[model samples]
Structure formats: C-alpha cells, structure tokens
Target: MQNALKELILQMADDALVLGHRNSEWTGIGPMLEEDLAFSSMAQDKIGHALALYTILHEHMGEPDPDKLGFMRKEEEYRCCQFVELPIGEYDFTLARHFLYDHAELIRYEMLVNCPFEPLAQMARKVRGELKYHVLHADTFLRELARGTEESKARMQAAIRYAWPYALGMFEITDADAQLAAAGAYAGEKERRSRWLSTVSSIINDAGLQVPEPDEAKAIYGGRKGYHSEYLKPLLDEMTEVVRLDPTAEW
Candidate 1:
C-alpha cells in the first residue's frame, strides 16, 4: 500500500517538475507579452506544486528531502509521462498539449480531493483550486485560435491531432495503479482517462475541433516504467545543472 502510494506521488511530482521547466522556456519568447507572462506564472505554479508533493513524500513516505528527490534522480528514475518530456514545439502544439494535460490534471486532483489518504487529499484540494486557472487559459487559447483565420483553424486542428496520442499517454497505467486504487489512495488512471476524454471532447467539439478517435490514436506509453524518449536525459541534465554546480549550497 505504501509503495503504491509512493509511486503515485512520485509520478505526479515528476510530471509537474518537468512540465514546469518546459513552460518556463516560454518566459521571454512567447509570441505576445501577455502570454509570455502567463506561461511564466503557470511555470511557477507547477514547480511550486512539485515542491509541495515532494515534501509530502519526505514527510510521510521516508523519501529524501524535496531538493534531493527532485534534482538527484537519474532520467530513468523520473516517472513523468513521456508526453511532458517532449520539446515544446510550435505555439499551437504547446497550447494543445496544455489544453489536454491541464484538464486531465484537474480531473485527477478532483478525484483525489476526498481520497482516503489525508495528506494527499489535503494537497489535492489546494492543487485543484490552482488547476482551474490553467484549464481556463488553455481552453481560452484553443477556442480563440480555432475560431480565427482558416490557417489558424487548420494549424490548431493539426496540432490537436498530433498531440492526441501523446496526451493519452499521460494516463498510462502503472503496476502500482491497481493497488493504489484498491487501497483508496487513488482512483486509477483508467478512470481519470475516461473522465478526461469526455470532458475534453466536449470542449474540443464546441471549439470547432475534432477529437481524434481513441482507437486510431495509439497511446505512446512506457514512461511509467522508467522508459523515456531521448529528450528527457537532456532535460534532466539542464534542470540539475545548478544543483550539480554547488550541491553544498543551502537553498
């Protein structure tokens, strides 16, 4: 039970940490100044959330302190889904990924708000509150872009299609998922995926976009098992550079 819970927490924390850095990449380069500030703000929120979850692990699960657990892990030891590890490509693709991911995240935390694990449930309540803003930002961009010129609609559609499979990969079930669900620690990935699909499909259709057929979009899994694309190791190297430079420095 404890191991399953630990796995669940690690996966969530790793996902937040990696995606936070990816979002931070847009701090100065976003196409517009408002968007630039928005992504930067969201990036801070994500990293803060990661730190909170890592602290939970340290407090309850006997893991190392948040700093060590976050920066010292090898690429293969990080449990973030491969979807978040991919380079933030064009703006359309990034927005599409954000739309897909934040909705799923909101749903996952919503499910956990009343979970049996008091520590996690307490955190989930706080996370769900913050996630609402993320979903709103993603949804607004998706709709506005899809309703723009023909080229904008076409690009948004293409980006959504391209992101669909990888988005599904976000819910890849782990070995511990079943145990987590059975023990009331979590509701499991399948349930979250189901709710996410329904929730996002409605928004996508209303925005004049097509949600790709699930059968045709084969999820790009394996990340839950510590398997990742070539992108992750490089990302980790960059993220941990400061820590490596001066491990003894106090935060």
Candidate 2:
C-alpha cells in the first residue's frame, strides 16, 4: 500500500512540476499583460503543490528529498502524462489544453479530498481550493475565445481537436489503480474521466464549441510508464540544469 501510494504521489508531483514549467514559459510572452501574470501565478501554485506532495513522500514514505526527487530524476523515471510535456503551441492550443487539463485536475483533487490517506487527503483539500481559480481562468478565456469571432471559434475548435487525444491520455490507467481504488485512497481515473467529460462537454457546448467524440479520439499514452515524447528530454535538461551544475550547493 505504501508503494502504491508512493507511485501515485510521484506521478501527481511530476505532472504538476512539468506542467508548471510549461506554463511558466509564458510569463513574458502571453497574449497580454494580464494573461502573462495569470499564467505565471498559476505556474507558481502548481510548483508549490508539487513541492508539498514531494515533501509528503520524503517525510512519510522514505523517498528522496523534494529537491532531488524533483530535479534529479532520469527522463524515463518521470511519470507525468505526455499532455503536460507537450510544448505550449499557440494561444488557442494552450488555452484548449489548459481547459481540458484543469477540469480533470479539479475533479481528481476533489475525489482525493476524502481519500483514506490523511496526509494526502489534507493536501488535496488545499490543492482543490487553489484549482478553483484555475478552472475559472480557463473557463472564462475559453468561453470568450470560443464565442468571440468566426476566426477565434475556428482556431479554438481546431486546437481542441488537436489536443483532445493528448487530453484523454491524462487518465491513463496504471497497475496500481485497482489497489488504490479498492483501498479508498483515490476514486480512480476512470470515474474522474467520466465526470471530466461531462463537465467539459457542458462548458464547450454552452460556449458554442464542439466536444470531440470519444469514440473517434485516440488516447496518446505511455508517459505514466516513463515513455515520453521527444520534447520531454529537452525540457528535463533545462529543468535540472541549475541543480545538476552544483549538487552540493545550497540555496
């Protein structure tokens, strides 16, 4: 059970860390000033969440310290979903990915709020609260862009279609899923995916956008098992550069 929980925690932490880095890349290059700040703030929240989760693993589960766990992992050792590792392409594409991703996150954390694991449950409650604003920000921008103009709608729809497969990969099941679910440690990805589809479909339909049919979408998987796109290697190199340069140095 401890091993299963550790795997879950590591995956969640990796997801947050990788996506936070991707979002932070937009700090100075967002479509506008407000958006730049918004993404940056959310990035900070995500990285903070990752740190907290890693701390739990260190203090309770005998894992490496947060810094080493976060910054020194091999590329194949990472368990982040491929969706978060993908580069933030364009404004519309990034917005679409953010909308899909955060809804899943919000639902996942909500499920974790009642988990049997006390430490994780407490952390979930706090993280879930922070995710509310992330959902709000993504929903607001998605709605406006989807309903704004013919071109905006077209671009958003295209972006959604392009990102849909990767978004589905966010729910890739793991061998430990059954054990975790049975133990009430988590509600499992299958349930979360169902709720996520319902929520995102409603938001998309209400905003006059189309939700890609699940039957027609192919999920891109394997990231949770350490397989990743070409992009992840470069991203990891950049992420760990400072730490790797001086492992003995302290902040």
Candidate that would win on lDDT = 2
TM-score of model 2 (CA atoms): 0.98
Q: lDDT tens string, model 1, 1-251?
A: 98888888898999999999999999889999999999999999999999999999999989999999999987789999999998999899889989999998899899899988899999999989999999999999999999999999999999999988888899998888999888877889999999999999999999998989976249999788899988999999998888798889875
What pairs collide in candidate 2?
Answer: none
TM-score against truth, every candidate = 0.97, 0.98
Off by over 4 Å in 1: none
lDDT of each: 0.91, 0.92
- Candidate 2 per-residue lDDT over residues 1-251, each given as its tens digit: 78888888888999999999999999899999999999999999999999999999999999899999999889999999999999999899889988999999889889998888899999999999999999999999999998899999999999999999999998999987888988889878889899999999999999999999875249999998999999999999998788787889995
Query: Residue 104 error for model 2, in Å?
Result: 0.4
**TM-score of candidate 1 to 2 decimals:** 0.97
Worst 10 residues of 1 by lDDT: 214-223
What does the lDDT come to for candidate 2?
A: 0.92
